[model samples]
Target chain A: MNRFLKILFFALLVKPMVLLGLGLNVFFKAKLPKQGPAIVVANHNSHLDTLVLMSLYPLSQIHKIRPVAAADYFLKNKLLAWFSLNIIGIIPMQRKHIRDTSALFAQCHRALDDGDILLLFPEGSRGKPEQLSDLKRGVHHLIKSRKTLKVVPVMMHGLGKALPKGEMIFVPFNCDVVVGDAIPFNADAKCYIDSVSNALNQLLALCMTRQSVVKDDLE
Target chain B: MFNIPIHSFYMMTFVVILLITGSLIRWRLQVKNPQTDYLELKQRIQSWWWMIGILFGILLAPTTVSIIFFALLSFLALKEFFSIMPTRQADRRILLWAYLAIPLQYYWVATNWYGMFLIFIPIYVFLFLPMRAVFIGETKGFIRSLGTIHWAVMLSVLCVSHIAYLLQLPVKNEQAGALGLVLFLIFITQFNDVCQYIWGKTLGKHKIIPKVSPKKTWEGFIGGVITVTLISGFVAPYLTPLTMVQGFVAGTLIAISGFVGDVVISSVKRDLAIKDSGTLIPGHGGLLDRIDSLIYTAPLFFHFLYYLHY
Candidate 1:
């Protein structure tokens, strides 16, 4: 009976937050990756994208969606440290430190080998909503190093409007998440990075186009 | 230590009936807009489950254990309250007092010292809180810091300590008066929330205060009050020291006070431009979201019962 109540309590608490995110997905018609052991590369718009992605997938798949957040931002305090490691299970990467590059890449590789989904923002940092930032080399190393892994480009639009950088408030707005087909990769390091970056740009453009169409319909 | 009584069984039955009727009504309403309505219904079910767990803990757990549980909840709720509202570095000493005052207040309740419990915050802490700030010697924004700390101490420490105070009530045969009272307030207050939402969604027409809470409607408010009154009129005889009419009136006051509490917290969130206090609870937004209605209802209900029965 105690176990049953514990499970019931968790369901009640987790479902609403998940549904809020899922509601955003339904409104935007979010497309999620169909397979696992893939790298989900999305534009860094806002904090809501992580939840949007988690809600778009099933609970079984949620555990596999390991969001790679900057260590400095997420691990700054004890409370946030617990939330990131235990609640969200984020993969902490040292964004500012060049010395920790190899260790971070190894961690990503371990996650892939364990059949987990890796969520990476290729831009390395949040940028202006209108344009994509230059792709970071982390994506390049992850894809080329692992031959079996797939690279799926995801574009999250309107999260900047929903909750932007340095803003505490979150306005309810239509945010779109588009998951494109996997970009094929080979062992060639340079080619793999270029191909993934190009695919990500294309997916982002599609998201922008879809957002405009939505705006037209609303108007 | 399990000291489950016959009354515990009665409370369990009451909760079960509430869950069934509430869930059935909520589920039945989702025929039109299935997605959003379904989500809302799911949240209601989850809230009910939490309510049951808390009720069970209060009823079955040992006195020491339950008091600790209430203390922990007060600490968290108080922490969440202060985190959202702006505070100054100068207010640090007052916050230290706030944390220290929680255990001491609950100690008064646990020992059944009604007089000390009542005046601990209003008389003693009230006088000392500002003095602690004065010692800091930072007069810059002094009034604002003092006001914020005083409000926090009142709401988080004084208001919530009433739950502990209920545990101290002396009844014939040393019956579970405190537990019953706590259970009574929690059940009626949260049920008011559920009934109001259900009532508003169905028969709602005119918005009560569209600027403060767009979802609240007069139809829902009336329906919620009537339902809570009817339920309390029947249930209070068993769970509380009040007569039938007194219970009904108490329930009505709870519904009204709960509505104000919900709106007041919503206004604060609006000022901060955030949604859902924090993401601690699943269906509920945060600890604050779950307890927003209780902030006013707990204190009011305690005082009402205290004056009449104690």
Candidate 2:
């Protein structure tokens, strides 16, 4: 029943609002992973980021696409927590002080193990709207032991200006989502994180230059 | 049920036939030149089907739906205008109020309140917007912000709303009613644009405005004016109250104003160093790009009919 409601929620509300309310220009959509056992990392801005990223996939595969959000923020109250968990289908990560790093992303690792795609925002928390912040290293830690996982870097622009943090009203702004080539899990932690950061930066540059993959390839 | 003029059906049929012809030409071109890609033309043709479908649906629906649809278009156009132009951080709230005015403006149209509709944007919005921005306490770029915001509302909302206002106009002919006028204006304007493009592509020479819109040429402009004027003269009596001569004059006005509107928008995009307004329509670039000619023609045709018929 919850799964049915999740699909219904996305199909009815989220998809239309994301498509119409905020016009999205997705580039190199072919690079997105069709199935799971992968991580889609993007720069976090507005709360709409998760929805926009999730709406990129077909509704049939929506159950497999899990977004990793902060437990404290999403699970702060009963209603939000229930909605986020059941409807949004987010895997909450505890952001508080943790002695063991493995326990923190255990839920994320389990999701990936279940052949589910994880949508991660490596910026830890939503930073200043429309500006990229430092990486929190949580994503790198999550993917360290998982060598087979493919990390796809995505850069989203204009959502922050549309509905940034603390703003209730949404200004209709055209958004751009650029997907980069998938990166295999690197053994070295520094190399892995650097590669993800570099991939994201390159995607950001694509948005800045307004360069999109050939329209024919979009098919 | 709401009334859709018989002429609208004929016009829609004509458009569909044109679309079929366009598709056939593309198919033939593909067969002749296998290496050359016709993706852009293909995308454009596909978009036209969707556009015409939505337009005819609205025309068939009740008057309130048409008003609401126009209001949505105004909102979307303003959103595109705001998106492309540089907006000041202080005037963000002011922009919201500008969006809010869309429904109110359309409400006036729905109620047939012409007196209020005419002055609400030009007088009230014109005076109130700058005052609203002043409350933000940011005096920087005051003139620039107010200028762009005011122009955005005027072009996107006030000008475009005239098309919706046509539905409210009292008409002499019951068969055509107001829908025919709406259909006539929109059809002629879009038709004029297509005529200009074809003329320009085939026999274009002597660039009209090389600095702003490089592709526009004198041959195309004159060819479009003559063709649209003649077509307008032929069809005006059937669709509108205008006689053959009046239709010819109206067509000439629309053809010239449509060119002006296209160039005006082209200049705005040129200033921003951008090609298109936004990516709302698939091949057309944006709603603004598709309706740039309508922006000018709507108001002019509305006023022209208002003075003569209404």
Candidate 3:
């Protein structure tokens, strides 16, 4: 019943809302990994970002995709935790002070081991609207030891204006999602993190150009 | 039982034949040339099939269904308009209101409330949007934001809604009712576009507006106008209440206005420096890109028909 509900939820609600209600123009869609054992990292802006990313995949692959979300925020309340876990299938990560950091990513590592695709927002939290903030090291930490892991960077534009961080009144906006080629895992943490940031920045630049052709027309 | 008019049946049959012929030609061309790039033509035919399929569904469905379909079209167009054109953060709520006005405007047309349909976007929504933006208290780029938002709504919603309003007109002539008029407007406008492209590609020499629309040529413009005018004269008598001469005049107006509409959108795209409006349609670029000519011809044709027949 839970499995049926998940498919039904994504097929009936999430897909239509993301694909139809808020139009998405995905560029380089061929770059999105078809299978699991991959990390799809994107610059987070609106809550819709996760849904948008998940909706990009086929419904049959819903169970194979797990978004790595901050545990405290999504799991603060019982209802949200239940919905996030069962419905969204988010792999909750502990962001607070921790004695052993490896324990925090155990679930993620297991999911990867199981060949499940994990979605990560390396910005830690939804930053100021559309602005990209500093990259969190959690992604680098998660993949530093996993040399063969495939990490894809996706940059989304205009979703922040659609829903943003706090405002609930949903306004329709055309969003552009550009997917970048997979980045090879680096043993050096900073180098890997910089590579991820650079990849994301390039994807973001692609999204910007995709929306506005006239350079000076953009504010 | 679907109460589809007889004329619509004929139009559908004609479209079927047109598509079959188009496909056959593409196949023959491929077989002969074997190496020519037909990707654009292939995409166009595919998109046309889908578009015509949707049109058939709309025509066969009930009044409410058609209204909702056009409403969805307006929403998509307006979304594309906003998606390409820049908008300030302050007018977010105003944009919401701008979207809200679409349904209300269409509702007026559905109810056959002419007073509200004519004035809602131009008068009420126009004044309300700017005032609502003022409440946001960000005076930065005030005129720029207001002008963009207002013009976007007017073009995407107000202008496009005229097509839907054609459905609401009371039938004066049994030969061609409101649906016929709607069909005549759309068919002729699109026919004008196709003819213009063919004429331009075949005999285009003099550039009409090289900066705005590079593909457009004087030969194409004059050739398309003449073809559309002659064709409209023949088709309008069956699809609309206009006689041969009146149809000729209407066709001339639709042909000229369609060109203007096409060029106007070209200028807008040129200003934005974007190639297409949005990626809604596969071969046709975007919904706005496809309907740009219709946006101008719809209202002009509607008012022309209204003033004459009604």
Which candidate wins on DockQ? 3
What 10-residue stretch in candidate 1 chain B is worst by lDDT? B169-178
Candidate 3's displacement at residue B23, Å, is 1.6
Candidate 1 per-residue lDDT over residues B1-310, each given as its tens digit? 2554445456767788877887777767776567664775588587767767775766567776777777767776665555455555345456667777888988887787778988998999889988888887877677866777678678777887777667666752224355777778888888899899999999999999998889999999999999998998887877777889989889999999998888988887776565765545667766778888888999899889878876
Lowest lDDT 10-mer window, candidate 3 chain B? B1-10
Distance from true location, Cα of A156 in model 1, Å: 19
TM-score of each: 0.60, 0.91, 0.95
Q: What does DockQ give for each predicted structure?
A: 0.05, 0.22, 0.42
Docking outcome class, model 3: acceptable
Candidate 2, residues B58-131, lDDT tens digits: the string is 97788999999999999888977876676654566888899889999999999999999999999999999989
Worst 10 residues of 3 chain A by lDDT: A208-217
- Residue clash pairs of candidate 1: A13-B282, A14-B282
* Model 3 accuracy (lDDT, Cα): 0.87
* Candidate 1 A-chain TM-score: 0.79
Instruction: Mark the regions of model 1 whose C-alpha exceeds 4 Å error after superposition.
Output: A1-219, B1-8, B21-40, B89-94, B134-140, B172-177
Q: What is the TM-score, restricted to chain A, for candidate 3? A: 0.93
The true-versus-predicted C-alpha distance at residue A217 of model 1, in Å, is 43
Interface RMSD of 3: 3.8
